[model samples]
Target: MKKILAALVVLVTIGTGSYSYAASAEKAFARVEKSGTIRCGYFTWQPAFMKDPNTGTLSGINYDFMDKVGHFLGLKIEWAEEVGIGSVTEALGAGRIDVMCASMWPDPAKMFHTEYTLPTYFSAVYAIVRGSDKRFDGNLNSINKPEVKVCGIEGDITANASRAAFPQANFVGLPPTADGSQLILSVVSNKCDVMLGDAPLLIDYSKTAPGKIRKVAGVDPVHVFGEHLLVNKGEHHLKMMLDTAITTLVNSGEMDKVLDGYEGVYGAPEKAFKPLR
Candidate 1:
């Protein structure tokens, strides 16, 4: 009788554990459906996600895309919080936000903690240097030397790319909170000799600081990364829903229209590239 009681208790505990695991797996999607709102954690990157300081109005390619996505799903998108690029995964894992509406580069490191929806677009990464500097002009190999100083936002794609491409170069990593301007400043001040970034970001900065920086000419892009919306890992339902909505927008040309509206005004088509159909 004692053995039977112990066996029954063990089975009940195992069953309860399995039930809890299943509940946790669907928790994120269930919460969003129950609330009818998808809370967003966004990072502020120009032309991608931007916040108007005085009015607190949010506008940009990702902002518009997400708005349309919410409409398609019949759900409200709440701009719940602004997250730093480095800690975006942590924010998602903590349940502070339902999804990261901001378009992010899906690198291997980030894949560990997050699941990404279908890519909305692509961006080419370039090596940027001072405008007057010509050491690496035609010789891409010059920048890979140990003496070259590469600066990029800590934990960002550009920094990771640089480290991968130029193993011998010295890496100067800025805080995750550092912005494009800060990275540009690092190059301008000669704190770093080279920096890696997307063309749109470099062009935008060039507008403000003319003749300060220029991309290395006559070389292929360092890398091309697909930009994706991020959700916490294991939120398969949420990811599937988002992927469906994105495919609808892309196929119907609505996504292109959104990108067109921001072109020249916020760097699209020229700086950002649309995904190939």
Candidate 2:
């Protein structure tokens, strides 16, 4: 009888927890719909997404895509100023933003802190080096040697991934915000030997400068992952809405227009973000 009672208690406890989560999710769902504005936190990254530093402009596939989501939801996308990737979890928890539209990768460490929508995109990490510095080219083993000075921005996901993957090499960390400008500058100016970052951004950077920085060709990504929009934890309804909106865009072919130059992974479109036809 005691064992049966204990089992009943366990079931009841689990039921209560689930109910609490559902309640919180409903609050979040109603909150966004009531406010009529989804405040999206974002940072200025590169290639696929960024807030232009010079003009303070938010222009990228992320912005363009999320704008459509807001429209469909009968809400306006209120752009919230977010400076660094490291502080995104804090921003969402502190109620600074309703969602994170920055090209944020759902790192394992952060998974417990926030809810993530299905990935809107996928990108590969590459080694950024000077065009003339062909030392590591086609040689995966070369970058792991101690002589190679690989750098990543402090608190950035790449920092942890690169450090873990290349323990043999000297991995350095620049201050926050270096992921955009300073990381590349360090590689180009010889302040660092190499940078492990997104391949598309590095390729575009190399093109702009012609030879200042180039991707180490033929090196498969040390890390490849999907990017997702994030919201506060327990906001299950909010996440579902976001997931549906993303799939809707993909199914209707409007996502192709926004993701024109970016790479991503899309699931089968089930629910439409709007009318399919």
lDDT scores in order: 0.80, 0.70
What does candidate 1's lDDT look like per residue over 55-151, in tens digits?
A: 9999888999998998887788999998888788889999999999988886778888899999887777788999998889877788988899998
- CA lDDT, candidate 2, residue 245: 82
Residue 195 miss distance in model 2 (angstroms): 1.6
Q: List clash counts for every candidate, in order.
A: 0, 1
Q: Find the 10 residues in a row with the least total lDDT in model 2.
A: 265-274
lDDT of 1: 0.80
After superposition, candidate 2 runs with Cα above 4 Å error: 1-22, 25-30, 261-277
Q: Model 1 Cα displacement at 49 (Å)?
A: 1.4
Off by over 4 Å in 1: 1-24, 270-277
* Candidate 2 TM-score, C-alpha based: 0.81
102-132: candidate 2 lDDT, tens digit per residue:
7676576677788889867666667778888
- lDDT score, candidate 1, position 141: 80
